[model samples]
Target chain A: MRQSKLVGTLAVLPSFVIVAGFMAFPVMFAFYISFTKTNGLTYDWRGLDNYIAIFSDPIVHQVFLNNFKFLISVPLVIFSALVCSILLFEQFKGWKFFRVIFFLPNVLSVAVIGLIFRNAFGYDGAVNQFLGLFGNEPMQFFIDSNYSILIIILALVWSGFGYQSLLLLAGLTSINPAVFEAAAIDGAGWWRRLWSITLPNIRKVLGFVFIINILYTFASLFGFVFVITAGGPGYETTTIDFLVYLRAFSSNNLGSGAALAVLLFFFIGLLTLLQNRVFKLQKDD
Target chain B: MSDSISSRLTPRAKWPIFIGMCLVAATIIYPLFFVVVTSLRSNVDYKRDPFGLPVDWTVTNYIELWDEYGVGRAFLNSLFVSTSAVAVILILATLAGYALAKLPVFGSKFFTATFVSVMLLPGPVLIIPIYLVLARLGIVGDYSGLILVYVATGLPFAIFFLTLTFRAIPDELLEAARVDGAGFFRTLWSIVGPMGASGIATLAVLQFLGTWNELIFALILVPDAQMRLLTPTLATIGKRFVSDQPLTSAGLFISALVPLLLLTFASKYIMRGLQVGLSR
Candidate 1:
């Protein structure tokens, strides 16, 4: 037994070492740095001041709200993906072709997607040309903060739905054909069979997709906002990540950035736990 | 009555999917077609007809981008970084996953929990600290630093999928190899690795995709122009050519081509691989 234990420890040693050296230690170091008013390598301990400044700053409040805005948009995008998946789930001619095309945006880098949309929404852009048909003046999509956020949301949905649709398609495929056949034999219509059979069976996968999508969407806010707007028009779309980048790099306020990082960590952690609980209950049911 | 209702609904019910598929296809394909057309059009023509098909197809945009924008260097850099990161991730994740799945690893639960928890930590959360660490090591703004960060970031999901794949391999196969007098490494080499080839390939594609498309870490960690990857190069093009519609469109399409080709060729494996990662 002791020999087995030794062998087991030996087996896991490399992974443990790597994770400790890289992820865990850096996380703890960042947390420690949050309490200090140091600029990068300089060490000047200031307890609670960094945290206090975050709460007092109006910019931080705006960033916190922007982060929530990004988070809340996930469900809307996921819902569209769900509907798309349902439509694409059935067997049809050109199904595979359509699948590839829809998933194309997901494969492209977010930076590239942002660039494409940035041009599409610019003055003298394709979107303006389309709107010109209806006799409306060309509106500045990027200049207006509200429209900028909306444009980002649309891009997010476009890039995001493909992957989620693919996931849901997988989930849908896994459902037993006989169940649907049986529902039909019992005189159930398409909506009835779908409501009674498909939704419940795929609920677990849907929940998992929701959690992953939410986290991914939140993580990606920086790239899109950075590439397109740079949180412009007076920081209207400045998310937590962009704000941290601004504070740390732009303004050289490392201490405040670290504090914001810590808060962002806890916020994401709380959402993850909540998602886990929701998934767990669904699984148990 | 139920049979009659079912028969009546079958034809009409398919319309929703038909409409949905059409909408999804248009949304995805229109932008792709737009990019391609714009890339082939002259700058003047592009400005005149931003939404129209090119009257004369040409490769000038691509040629100019390659010659002027340092796209070739960025492409090579992206290739180098992605391939190196995927190679490292595969080796480490495979060994770790096999050990966890097959061997009696002590505190395996804790290790699994640790890796999964790392997934919960958002990518942006690590940017500042990782940058600081790389700066301390004096490797910031270099390829090696970016590669290291990419490997670390890709490790968790790679291991997660590999562990599942390893666990699915039959214990009887390992026992059979052992009965033939093969040692652990020999059994792993001769038996386990071949059996897990498909899984490994899937993971490799995923690791490659994730690293190739990663922009945030690449942007933050590598400040030098020569070291910038393809995504950042595209971002630079956007910054430089804010009004140059054709050039921007060409750059976007050029940057997307590699990943698009990678996906098209290995799409089956890519889809399977993504399913594994996302499911976990």
Candidate 2:
């Protein structure tokens, strides 16, 4: 029995070392470093200064607002995914092929997706070429602030709706077909059935997608911003991650960068707690 | 939207849904088609008519990209890092996840919570101290450093996934193997490995795609031009070749190739893996 316990310890030791070193430790260190100003590996304790600066900074304010603005993608993604999933759930014809192709973008590299989106909407790209057929000039999509954010959302929807739809499809699959059939027998139209049977049944899945999309909008916008706008025209579309990259590494301002990061950590932590709570409340899946 | 009732609907009702789906599929396919066509064309041909079918189709961009540009090296680096990390992830996650699931390991519950909670840590910010830690260890420029980071980050999902997968395996099989004089490693190798093959394969495919597509960590950890990965190379070379669409598209095609191949081949596992993650 003692030897078996020892063997179990040996088995788990490698994973424990890596996780503790990389993930667990850094989180605690992020809190520690956030409080102090640093220069050239020299640290000076400056309590709350870093936080106050970022809070008061207008650029940081705009970046947070940009994140909130990007939250608009959540509903757009859900609505698009919901409609597609419902349609696909119908399994009309070619649904299998469509399902496969739809999942492709979800697995694609962000760098590649960002490039494709950039090219598709670039001044000399396809959208412009189509617009040119009507004698209109090519439009600059990335350089402008409003258009840049819009394009990112469009790209997110393009890449994400498929995955979310499949999730909804999974949810829709679990829902006993009898419910839909019974609703139909009771004179429910498609919309009526969807609202009463479909939507209500899939709320848990919807909530999951909703929270993840929100988390994604916060955590994973870096590649798009880095590749497409480069946070351009003047930090207009810069996401928190991109800003952290800039503030922490590029400008060599680790102190305040770490400060903003700690704030982001708490924000994401709060959101995840909320997600856990939602799931706990639902307690279904 | 189930079978018995939908089967009663006339074929006429299917048209709108069919066309709408086709339109959605087109949104995905058309752009990719344009990318493939553009990559195969000469820059001048692409330049002369961005919308036209290629009059001068050639693999020159791909050939030149491999032979002259640093893409070949980046490709190799990406392959090595992704494969190495996936291998490590499989070994580590399997052993740990197996223990957590099947063994009377001490602190199993605590270990599980520690790993899972790490998943929710904000990545963009989390990279900072991770970078600092790697730098502190002076492994920032080492392939081992980047590989370790990938393995560490990927373990949570892989372990969590495998835990669920392993929990489904009946204990009687393992007990029988043990009763037949099989030790822990032997049972794990002959029994658990084969039994859990599909789930493990699903994890490998998912992790490989993830590591291949990763950008920021590779960018930050391995900054040397000689050691860069594919996605970050795209960012760097993307800036350098903004005007040369064919060459840039060729780079895009190269970086996107493996995951596309994985998607094409292991799409069953990919689909299963993705749908399964919703339970988390």
Candidate 3:
């Protein structure tokens, strides 16, 4: 009996070790290092000086603000995805074909999507050429700071919409068709049936989507910003993640980078907490 | 707000919605079209007529990207890393998943909870410290280092997923194997493993996709040209060929082809996996 127990324990040990070493330990270690000045080799305790540096740093402010700006797209994505899923729910002809086509971008690498968007929005690129047909002059999309950030957000929406829709479609499909039919029998219109029945049924899924979307907007925009803008226009497009990369690697300031990362961790934690509270309130209601 | 179900469900009024959806679909797929068409054209031809079919229809850009630009090496590197990651994850996650789901291991609930919490650890937050860990172990810029990171990143979800999968197996099958005197490993290998084949395949595809398109870790860990994966290598290529649209397009298309093909063939499994990941 003890021998079998040993084997069972041994079975889980490998994965536990890897996750503990690489994931759990670093999280704790990063928190520790954030309080100290470290440069790969040595460390000196600074006692919140690194955190102080983050507050005082204007660039960090810009990064934070840029991330908040990016959050604007969360609602936009959820709404658009909801609409697409509803359209797909109607079972229109070629609906499956459209679903697959929409999801094509999600399958492609983000690096490739970023690259494609950069090329497509170049001054003499396809978009401008299309605009030129209606007599619009070629505009520099990536050169301007505002336009640069706009392009990054647009690229994310384009790449992400399909996956989000598929997820919502799954949610929508899980709702019993009988409810809709009953609403129809009760003389409810499409919008009424959707609002009073379908929406309520998928509330859990929507909440989950909201939380994941927040997490995604906060961190996963790195690939798009990395390839398309490289946080260009003098760091106008730099996000917290991008700035952390720049501070730690590019500027070789490990302490500052760790501090910034800790701050991002806190931001995500707070967002998660907020999501929980919001959902809890809804559940109570 | 009218009650006539047929009025709403009839195909006549749905054309506009359908057409609108087709346009949305076009927007999603248009960039791919642009890239492919641009890839077949020279820089000058693309610049001259961005929307038009390639006048030149040149294969030179692809040849250059593959041979001279070393994207071919990056492709091989990505394949090697993803395949290696998938192999490691499959073994480790299977063992851990089976043990957690079926075996009467101590603190199984605690271990499963730890794995689930680990999934919430954001990728960016680990960049600094994981770099430090890799450096400490002297695996910096090494393929093994990147593969290790990939396995760690993929484990939490894979294990969580496979635990659910393995738990769904009728306990009777496992009990039957034990009645036949099958050992722990034997029962897992002979009884539980084959039963979870689809689950395993789903995990493999998802893990493969994760490591294949993983950029930040590859960018941070493997700096050497020979060791770089596809996405990070493409980023480097993106920087170098900022103005060379045609060449970069070819590189992007090449990077996209594998995952696109995988999605095309196994989309049902992929979507099913995603539904499990998200909704569960």
Candidate 4:
């Protein structure tokens, strides 16, 4: 037993070293940096000024609102993913082809997708031309600040739905067919079966996917906003991550950026904790 | 009764949903298709009808990208970085996973939990800190710096999946190897390694995809035009040369082709890896 214990310690040591040296240290260092007036290269302690400035900055407030917009869209995306997964889960001839097509966008880099859509939605672009067929004028997707966030949200949903569908499909497939057969025998209709049988069985996976999709979407809003719009048209779509980047790189306010990072960490952490509670509740039920 | 209910759902209901799905699919597929079509068209033809299918199919965009823009070099740079990063991730994750799974190490549970916690942290949160560290190490603008960061970022989830797979391996196999007088390394190499091939391959493909598709770190860390990865290069092309539609589309399509082909070939493994990586 002692020998096994020693072996286990030895086995896990490399991972421990790497994680500690890289991940843990950086995280703690970042937290520490939040309190200083560092310009990323130089470290000078500045107490609560960074945190205070962040709370007072108008752009920071805009970023918070943008993040809230992103957070609000999560449930809508999840619902769409759930509904589509159910629709696609049934046995059909072209199911695999549809699956491949749906999943195509997920594999491509978000940067490329941003570029493709940016051009596609430009004033003289295809989307406008297509809308011209219906007598509507071309709408500025990338340039118009009012519509920029919506475009990002749409692109995110389009790129993401496939993976969620796949997860739900896998969860659906794992349910014993006999249970469904029994449901059918008992005269449980399609909706009834979906609610009472399928939904209940896949709830755990649903909760997992929900938490992941929300967290990932929250984190990734910055990337899309960066690549597609660059928080353009007067910082309309500037998310917390974008703000952090601006603070650190553009404004040379590393302290403020670190404070923003800490706030983002807590917001995401709280959401994740709620998600875990939901998962635990489902497991218990 | 169930069949009747499903069937009796109004034809209008079915039609609207079907049409909606088709519209969504068309919207998603249109940009990708436009890129391919525009890439094949001459500049004049592209400007005339960027949405239309190419009237004259030509490899000029691809040829020009190679000859003029040096996208081929960018492609090679991305491939090298992604491959090296994936290789390191797989080796380190495997060894670490084996240790975590098989050994009764001190604070093993704590270490595993810590790794999981790090994985949940947003990538942007780590950027400034990591950037500072890389600068200090004199690797801020270096390819190795980017690869190291990718490997580190990817290791947590890779380790997580591999640990699960390793744990699933029957303990009796290890006991049998020990009975044959094989030591720990010998048992791990000879016994556990072969059995975990699928899991290893799955993790490798995932790490490859993640590192290959990553753009943010590549953009920030490697500002030199020559060393930029495919994603950043494509972004730059779009941002800087918006007028060069055909060439930019060609570049975008070229960047996407490899991942598309890989997914087509290893869809099963990718799916399994994603399920395990995300679900657990």
Candidate 5:
């Protein structure tokens, strides 16, 4: 029995090693480094100083605010996807074709999407050229902070709505048709059925989608921002992830970078806790 | 009764919804169309008619991207990184997934939960420490360093998927294999591996496409010109040569070609995987 257990352990040791070294260790190490100050070359333990420095900085405050502002897209994306999924659920003509078309962007590298959008929005590019016909000047899409944020969200929505809708569509498909039939037979309007039946039935997936949207907007926007804005126009468009990269790699300020990362990790952990609560509530019902 | 109601509602609802979906699809396809058309146009033609059909179509931009910008070398680099990462992830995750699913390993449940939670680690949040760790190990900017990060990031989803797949296989098969005196590894390779072929294929395709298109880690970790992957290379071009629409467009298409094909063909498997992975 011990030998068999040893074999089982051995089977998993490689993955365990990789995860521990790359993921687990770095997380804890990052937390420790966050409290220290370094010039990217060396470090000194100054407990809470890095955290204090970051929170006090107005630019860091703006990055956090921008991140939370990006969260507004959460409900917007979910609602749009929910509506689209409901439409697709009707098995409309070419529904599969539409689904495939929508999901195409999600599959392509975010880097590619970012590049395409960057070019499309570049000065004298297609978007500008189109605007020029209306007598508008060529705009610096990445230079303006508000404009950059809008562009970032546009890219996110363009690439992700199809995939999110597909997830919701899967959730919709899992509902028992008889339940819908019962609702229909009881004289519930379409809106009534959707509000009470469809929404409740997909509560768990909706929660998951919301959590994923937060995580995505928080961390996964790195590639897009890196290519599109590069956290440019003097950090006006910087989200936390891009800011962290800027501090760490570009500026060689590891301590402050790690501090911001720790905060981001805690933010994600809170979301995870909320998700678990939702899961429990879902299971309870 | 339900059929009749839906049928009655169809006329008013269906056409508007169809048109809306068509508009959405058009929006989704527009940028991609722009990329392809602009890639085909010469610089002079692009300047004249940025939004309209390319009047002077040319493959010169692609040739230049490949020959001058060394996109071919970057493509090979991306291919090597993605394939290597997939290979590493598949072997390790399959073994781990099988153990957690079938083997009577104590703490397997704990490990499974830990693995799932790894997805929530917010990847960019760890860039600082990971960079430090890799630099400490003297592997920063190396192919192996980037590949390791790719393998680690891709591991959790692959393991979760494979664990679910492995669980669906019957216990009797493993018992029968053990009866034949096949050892653990041997049984896995012979019985489990073949049985889990579809799961393995899904994992491979997903991981390959993911690592192929991954840019953040590649951008930061592999900064060397010779080591830069396709996505980062494309990004550099997009940033450095923003004025060269034809070249940038061609670079974008080339960067997207492989994964776009996979997304087009194996879309069903990918979506199913997303459903299972997300809804869990």
Candidate 6:
């Protein structure tokens, strides 16, 4: 028994070691370095000075605000996904082709998504060129805070809606047929059935989509911003992750960077806790 | 009687919805199509007519990108990192998932908790620390360093997927193997491994795709231009050479090629995985 347990333990140990070394230990190490001044070369104890400076800085405030503005993409993306999924669920003529084409954005690298959007919206790029024929002057995107962030949100919507609609479509498929039949026989029209029967049946899947996309809005917007704006035209469009990267590497201010990373960690942790609570509440019903 | 909810839609609803979907699909497809077309054209040709068929369609941009910008090398680097990490993850997750699903591994409870927490740790939080860990270990900017992060980060999902997968295999089989004087490891490799082949393959493919599409970690750890992976390299080009649409498009096309293919061909498995993920 002991030897069997030993073998089992040995088999499972490598994963733990890698996680502890790369993930677990560094989490605490990040906390430690957050309080100190360090850039992989120099380490000096600062004792909350880093946090103090970051809190007082207006750029950090703007980054946080930028992250909040980006949160607006969450509902926008879910709505878009819902619309697409609902349409695709109809299995209309050429639905298969539409479904495949729709999901194309999700599979490509975010860098590729960013490039497509940037080039399409660049001053001399396709969108402007098309607009130019309508007698409008050239307009620039991905160059400033508001315009670039708006473009980023549009990019997010374009990329995520199809993939998520697939998830919702799967949700719609798995739903029992009898419920839809009952709703239809009772004189519910298509839109009425969608609202009453289809939407109600997919609460859990909808919840799942809602949860992941919310988290994605917080943690996963980096690649989009990095390629499209590079957090540029100053610190205006910089979300938290890009700002953290910039502070840690580009700005040569490692302590504050570590501090920013740790702060964002706590913020996300709190958000996750809150999200889980809401989800659990919904599940209880 | 309930063939589809579509049965309820009047012709009016169906026509408008179909047209709307067609417009949406056209919007999504045209930009990617434009990029591919632009990639084939020279800068001069693209400038001459951005929307037209490539007047002087040439693969010169691709050939030049390969020779000059090291994008080809980066593609190889991306492949090596993604594959290497997936290989390690498969091995570790298979053994560990099997143990958790069947074997009475000591401290299994603790291991499960740790993995769950680590899996939930946000990427922004992990980036600095993971990089610092690699830097501390003197492995930053190395392929091994990036591979290590991928394996570590990827394990939770792979193990979670496989644990559920391995559960469907009956305990009677394991007991039977044990009675045959087969040790636990031997049974795992022979009986469990083959039986769980489908799940293992799914795990491998998903992990490979996820790692291949990763950006920030590779961008930060492997900052050396020659060592950069495909997405990161493409980003550098997109940012630094925004004016050179032809060159940038060629790199974007290369970065997109494999993933686009996988998403097209293997979408069945991937969608099934997504369904499973949601159910979890």
**How do all models score by TM-score?**
0.93, 0.97, 0.95, 0.92, 0.95, 0.94
Q: What part of the reference interface contacts, as a 0 to 1 fraction, does candidate 3 reproduce?
A: 0.70
Top candidate when judged by TM-score against the true structure? 2
- Candidate 4's residue-wise lDDT over A64-162, tens digit each? 777777765677677877887777666443566667677778888888888787777766566777787789977767677768878887778878887
lDDT of 5 by residue, A1-285 (tens): 777777787877788788878988899999888888777567888999888888799999888888887877788788889888888888866888888887888778888888888888888788899999999999887778878888888888888888889988888888878887788788888889888998999878888888889988887788888889887778777899888888886665688889888998998899889888887776643
lDDT of 3: 0.85
Give DockQ for candidates 1 onward, in order: 0.53, 0.68, 0.66, 0.52, 0.67, 0.63
Q: In candidate 4, what are the lDDT values of residues B175-259, reduced to their tens digit?
A: 8888899987788788888999989988887788788889888988998987778888888777776666777788889989988
- Per-residue CA lDDT of candidate 3, range B94-181, in tens? 9999988888777777788788878877888999999999999999999898889889989999999998899999998888888899
Best by DockQ: 2
Least well predicted 10-residue stretch by lDDT in candidate 1 chain A: A1-10
Query: Please, what is the whole-model Cα lDDT of each candidate in the order they appear?
Result: 0.81, 0.87, 0.85, 0.79, 0.85, 0.83
Chain B, candidate 6: TM?
A: 0.91
Off by over 4 Å in 4: A1-4, A133-139, A282-285, B1-27
Q: Comparing candidate 1 with candidate 3, which one achieves the higher TM-score? A: 3
Q: What's the TM for model 4?
A: 0.92
DockQ of predicted candidate 1: 0.53
Give the C-alpha lDDT of model 5. Answer: 0.85
State the local distance difference test value for candidate 6. 0.83
Model 3 alpha-carbon miss at residue A87, Å: 0.9
Candidate 1 residue pairs that clash: none
Which ranking of candidates, highest TM-score first?
A: 2, 3, 5, 6, 1, 4
Q: What is the CA-based DockQ of model 2? A: 0.68
Write down the RMSD of all candidates, one decimal each. Answer: 3.0, 1.6, 2.6, 3.2, 2.1, 2.3
Interface RMSD of 1: 2.8
The residue ranges of model 5 lying beyond 4 angstroms of the native Cα positions read B1-13
Q: Please give the lDDT score at residue B26 for candidate 4.
A: 84
- Once fitted onto the true fold, the runs of candidate 3 whose alpha carbons sit more than 4 angstroms away are A1-3, A274-285, B1-8
The segments of candidate 1 whose C-alpha lies over 4 angstroms from its true place after superposition are: A1-11, A134-136, A282-285, B1-16
